[model samples]
Target: MKFLAILILLLNILSAQNNIGIDSLQNNTGIKNNLSELRTELDDIFNDPNFSNAFWGVSIQSLKTGETFYKLNPDKLFKPASLIKLFTSSNALLLLGSRYQYRTEFFIDGNISNGILNGNLFIIGSGDPTIMIEDTFEHWLDSLNHKGIFSIKGNIIIDDRNFRQDKYGAGWLAEYMEDWFAPTTGAFCLNKNAIEIKIEPTKIHQSAQISFNTEFIENYEVINHVITSTKNSAVEVKINRIGNNIIDLIGKIPVTTEPYSVYIPVNNASQYFLNSFYEFLLDEGVEITGNAVKLDEYDKNYDFNNTIPLFTHKSEQLTKIVSEINKKSDNLLAEQLLKTIGFEIYGYGSTSNGIKAVKELKQGMGINPNNFIMADGSGLSSYNLLTPKQVVNLLAYMYRSSEFDSFYKSLAIAGYDGTLLDRMKGTKAENNFRGKSSFLENTRGLAGYIKSADGEPLALALIVNNFLVPSQLANYIQDKVCNRLANFTRN
Candidate 1:
């Protein structure tokens, strides 16, 4: 019995030493698997006929052990598309805390006696982009009506002083300026600065019915030329903007099909907000004699200091807003948040200042700022370029920081919600992957965190450019790679 006990102790010591040896090997070499296997797998994926001419960049590292598991052209720059929102969002969380909220204040210059003797309504916006036409505007009107003020003899002045007059992002395509995904950015945005147009088919061979979601239908002249077709027929629809206020809709809709709706960005977002608010006030029984005007149109001598406070509309918390920006890939909200960072940190809200702030933040986070170029916050511009190393570095930094919880939770979970709702469903990566996905004409990217099979956390960034294959193919490759990472275990 004594001999057996001694033998068991010796075996236990040997097992402990073996485990330490394995850990020491991993720590010294940074990974347990042979680098050749990973390289060959990546080469096989990239060397496929579909990506014969594509440029690829990938970087993966274990968060727990700080081991670089794989790297392929990690330093090569590629268009990041919406993946750049990661920078904007993480930086926003670091600079502006998660509890930050945007405030829009209402100030009146004159007195209110017997619901009369009112003055110009000055609305000073702090770049709140979440204001919707349906609920937010109605709430503002209700606030006014609740205050016992129904009439405004003076004008409605919109003070978007928080941001510059530049509404469009730099390098944005002129053709896509009116697209819903590329709506204008401003201190005050309503309905995402877009209008919803619903088209329904009537009887077969009859003209299709057209309708607008907003009461400000007079804002645009619709020239509809649509014909209803038989069931199961191909439905083709096209909307073209001929002039500032003229929109031509030409299409063929099937009678059996449900109503189709499309959202288009307006020409001028500020004016659109004013028009929508004017209509909302009319509906709420509030009378305003003067026209809704921008702050620049008012006299320079108007005293803003004497303005009395009515009510302020506070936007949702920054955490929720950042989730919308990341999960939905909202361009306008990302741009606005970028500018807001600049305005909050510095005194001016401009893209240049915002980019400068982002660079400084990146530098502070130990990332080499010179490796990446951020022309626009939302990555809508083709000029935006980032190396996979830079993205992975950022993700790793965020993963280890105190703000990690907020930043990580804001990302799109695979097969769960956000932009990744329909992707990687029922797979090993379904709940194990959470990241940001990006797509442009010829660019695709995915970057964020993943959990390995042994429950080790990992940060990864994969970017592909100039691929002749469909973007879905790139997504499939990424999903497969993530699955491999999800099943990875240290031997």
Candidate 2:
């Protein structure tokens, strides 16, 4: 009787194990079907007539299960534009932690005896891109005043040796300099290496009143040819920067129109920063006997034993800075961060060094180095080539990293904030998608994460190039794909 009872128990245990295996198989099959449906929907979207002649690359994967739900030419290269910021930003977070802060130090080369004996006031820049002239300089002046120094007996020397001499990225077109987005780079950047010009209409037939955002207005020569017209007249303004510091304003503006403003890139970022600092010192009642000059070459044997440390200005944390880069797609800031990463890792700041560091970071993340080419950190270069699979891979890797939260929050959220403020509103993607948007002449891309109906997270990369359709149409297609992903469910 005992032997028969044991045999029955063994049979029952085997039956339970078999049933569990069957249930697991059924769940896997259901997931597969759901993924297939998602792929079909996305394929239909890609097949639309508008994108039929365009080059499309897309990849989507479930972050929860590590399953690829959809792919179309996932390994093909395409221009990623600002979507390259994802790599720059993510690699930055890994190399320099979220708490990292850029420090700009002030040092005096000579001794100070009763605020009279001084040689050169050195401002060593650590590439703080967000340094505001008004606020930052004011703080520095206050610190100097507190130190009982009213007059400087030396020149203001700008030490920007941390970065190389190249002020622009590779593959940048000269015509692009006219736009505010293409500001020159510098170790010590002020106001994003650009200044704002405000033009207001005056009396009829009279030239418009021109004003500047900075007090150093004398730095630039503006030839105004604008005239005020009737209230109903068409307002047309043409701003042309003829040369380095010469700007011509030619157009007509209605008297009733509000003041029109435009931002122009500074020809010499280092000089502009120095000039602005000089103006601020004068405003703060600090007198300098010598002119501001750049330290182009420094003797290697120079001793700093007698130099006095005044004060250091710490910039906003990297977390906030990265948010600005990704949200607004700040090109100049992104480039600066790239050089900074290179400087931090290889002891020198240059575009090549930065790209090398980025490659190293990618390899460290277990991504194949040859899969992508990053010519510039901001993707402003046409030479930048990346595959959808590579982008999704980065997203997935960052999703599991410790710095994921910081990197994720830095992305633009649909219908909420950042570059996506006006996109995907009132749809399934609203407030459900967080990603970066990219746009060039004939290219558009959207890559990031979306939460599905079942609360499953999905990593996605959608890139379209050489599209003859309107930009809005491209954005619409990308939005539809995101919406479908957001509504995806396994029933």
Give the range of the ten consecutive residues with the poorest summed lDDT in model 2: 24-33
lDDT of 2 by residue, 107-143 (tens): 8877777865377788888878998877877778888
What digit string (tens of lDDT, one per residue) describes model 1 on residues 395-442? 988987888999989999998999898776645677679999999899
lDDT of each: 0.82, 0.83
Stretches of candidate 2 off by over 4 Å are: 1-33, 113-117, 215-220, 233-235, 243-245, 297-301
lDDT of 2: 0.83
Report the Cα lDDT for residue 136, model 2. 78
